[model samples]
Target: MDMRETPGVTPPHPAPDVFGHVGYQLKRAHAALRAAMDQALRAHGLTVPQYSCLEVLAARPGMSNADLARATFVSRQSMNVVLRGLQDAGLLTRPATVETGRARPATLTGEGRRRLRAAQEAVYAIEARLVRAVHEDRLPALLADLDRMARALSD
Candidate 1:
């Protein structure tokens, strides 16, 4: 006899099919975006994390390593290595010593801004392609929905 057919029994909801699940779709989109970014950034000699760090620092100068790591979605340790590399490349600078706190603020040098500007052209082109894939009228709604979904899960 079917459990649902029994008067005293209750059946649990069936799991969603993986292929049609929202999470699966999101993962596929993310993978495609990552691959595209990787290829585009390669010509500029920048990794996704490195590019992200530069972008964030440009808008908010003097961000500490921890804050930059969080903004770039990388670990603190990984951000340290990235900072060191940028420092060596003359793309950014940090004080030799900190008197008040252990957190060292990072600022992009002139070369860093130039590099970021070049990379931004490639990144923005990719973003434009993505935006074109969606309907013009529905783009705003789609962005809002995506933000809402992220906030729901984060909360």
Candidate 2:
């Protein structure tokens, strides 16, 4: 068979939107949503990563930098950058842990909680709007599908 003359093979169709392809669409949508979220977080003086750190620390108040990196899916080096920024902002403090003299555990300052409360509202508002973009009944299925996709991708 000529390389170009396979009978069962079909030529690719033209597409207008980059997102017309499944992978492209998913990537584009992710970029769009993340950009929106980052902008929202900016208004509260937080970056998405910082907000994420705040949330995880809020939930588990004594996570070491390494533990925080694991929970937030970030590199320890990058986590240090964010942790330093938040600490400098007086939003959090990462002191040597009482349990482990070598590791630093993050504790949210009162200011961190205040900022987190506002950021949480904005984050949920973004979710509410994005969720409402789809049909109400489809939202649950969409979430399940997204969760499955994330799990598959992680694995």
Candidate 3:
């Protein structure tokens, strides 16, 4: 028998309105953040992905392309292209051949660090604006809630 027709069973509830749904709100915020980052990074001659890659590398140098791709939430193919562009721009370096494995770790050049520092100023300002929208005391709770939501979905 169909579950919906089973005795004592309840029908599924209708989905919430898009404007009222948490997932929808999260997506809207993500879209806005991406747009803001794109505009901010353009002045530094970087794309969102490129800036993400650089930011990751600065924190953890010598990361393989695959590692960087996963860290930046991009595809391996896309990361290869981003790395190549940065290498050509003299912002990063990757050895022509690896001694032990297929993954060639990438590191930022001096110029890359300088560019990242400049871009950080712009990106951090945008984040500051976002944080300022919420009450100071609520910020920690908000971050914790976001983390919990992510963990729940991931499981």
Candidate 4:
């Protein structure tokens, strides 16, 4: 089956030579990598977002719900879902937010820290493999380029 020129079923459109198209390809690549990372995290009973929240909380303890949502680039509703799951698992606790009485701060418990450590190790192992697959000389420039692309698209 020729995917690029599929038949009567209506083929997918090819990306034009444009920045948006290029960014889409980059995003697709990142999504694939994230899927692999998620698989790696599964053994620790952590989803990708859960692990991300743990990472963020570990680094910035007592982060407000909104701040965590922004840090993880998710909506507050989504953050609540993930936080709820983690809380149910006895991994984290939500306390009153200092800045906003209406919001709560998310903090990792000892159990969450332990699981996060294991998950972080798992993620690093997979990430190391992925990094090794990249060309050595291109890594720095590629990261810088990705940062620029992300900033441009986000703004």
Best by lDDT: 3
The regions of model 1 sitting more than 4 angstroms off are 1-16
Worst 10 residues of 2 by lDDT: 10-19
Supply candidate 4's per-residue lDDT for 139.
Answer: 93
For model 2, the local distance difference test gives 0.87
Residues 50-106, model 1: lDDT tens digits: 999999999999999999999998999999999998889888999988999899899
Judging by TM-score, tell me the better candidate of 2 and 4: 4
| Per-residue accuracy of model 4 over 59-138 as CA lDDT, tens digit each | 99988778988998889999999999999999999863456477787889999999999898889887888789889999
> Comparing candidate 3 with candidate 4, which one achieves the higher TM-score?
3
Off by over 4 Å in 2: 1-18, 97-101
Segments in model 3 whose C-alpha atoms lie over 4 Å from true places: 1-16
Best to worst by lDDT, what's the order? 3, 1, 2, 4
Q: lDDT of each model, Cα atoms only?
A: 0.91, 0.87, 0.92, 0.84
Residue 123 deviation, candidate 1, in Å? 0.6
Candidate 4 whole-model C-alpha lDDT, 0 to 1: 0.84
Clashing pairs in 3: none
Task: Indicate which candidate wins on TM-score.
Answer: 3
The clash number for model 3 is 0
Pairs clashing in candidate 4?
none
How do all the candidates rank in terms of TM-score, highest first?
3, 1, 4, 2
Greater-lDDT candidate between 1 and 2: 1
lDDT of 1 at 21: 59
